[model samples]
Target: MAGGKTINSVFRRLAEEETIRRVQTGLYDYPRYSELLDRTLGPDIFQVASALARKFKWEIQPDGASALNLMGLSTQVPAQYLFHSDGPTREYQINRTKLRFKRVATREMKFKQPESAVIVHGLKSLGPDHINDKTIAKVRDWLPEAKRRQVLRDTQTVTQWVRAAIREICKEPVHG
Candidate 1:
């Protein structure tokens, strides 16, 4: 219940039923679903390379957090928000916070977590580059010291080509 008014309670309940607990009210706790995803792919944020390729019906590699690991930017999390898709690739931003999504293919949509779904919309809205260096650094700093190197190494896997495309999309100044 991201501290919203009573009017939001009903939605919150629905979200919770979907394992999408309100972090405040309109906002929700996507991390909880991340943990669940680790245990089982159900109700996740659809944050995988194969998943996005399937969902968007495009052939694009991940570029942000998912790619960051490939780019030596950071190690992998037991589960972290994913990047990619047909629309736009970016972290969800609202009121200075970011929403996370679990990657999933179009066919796999049924398994995506309810919380992650809303958050993914936020990221899609932000577009790629929504996760800038500052945010990457923040994410890097947030992880445990032991995981820093691995994350950096993993982030390195994220190539600039896709990142540039995503940035282009984000910089488009367009919204649907």
Candidate 2:
């Protein structure tokens, strides 16, 4: 009638406009995020750790022994990240990796990871005996040479706590 457009066409346009508004405003549910999860899970351990930490709502630092293993300096395997969290217990089994998520005492919390990055930190996370001067020298080459001296200088301070902890954990004699 008004320029020859029909009333039925006007009403149909209005209905589509409402549906578009609802979808844009999040009135519809999409399961596509699960596909994202499926794509990221299992093969990517660190990604899974990050996702799991958020899923459980915790503060996490994937360093210590975890970094050492990823660095190829340690032959031993890590059982967990020793995540110092204010959250409850959570255990994530990502393929062969076992990540432990548990509550930590406030005093034990860390603000900065020693190795900076997760993979680097895992390489340095070994027991006291496992991190000898030779082992340290071997792993040092992996870092930029400029950083090696500083990392070596920090080793005494770095492994001090780890050495003490391993001794206490094993309840046995300690070695360098």
- Cα-based TM-score, every candidate: 0.23, 0.44
Which candidate number has the best TM-score?
A: 2
lDDT of each residue in 1-176, candidate 2, tens digit only: 35435754554566466432112111221212257456422234555566666766677655566556655666576655555466776775544667776677654443343343332345344544565555545454445545443444343343455534322322322458
lDDT of 1 by residue, 63-146 (tens): 345444433445554254454444454444433334344444654332133322222233333456565655434433434455
- Model 2: residues >4 Å from true position, as ranges? 1-42, 54-57, 63-65, 75-82, 114-127, 142-176
Once fitted onto the true fold, the runs of candidate 1 whose alpha carbons sit more than 4 angstroms away are 1-12, 16-18, 21-56, 70-73, 76-91, 94-176
Query: lDDT (CA) for every model shown?
Result: 0.41, 0.48
- Model 1 worst lDDT run, 10 consecutive residues: 110-119
The number of the candidate with the highest lDDT is 2
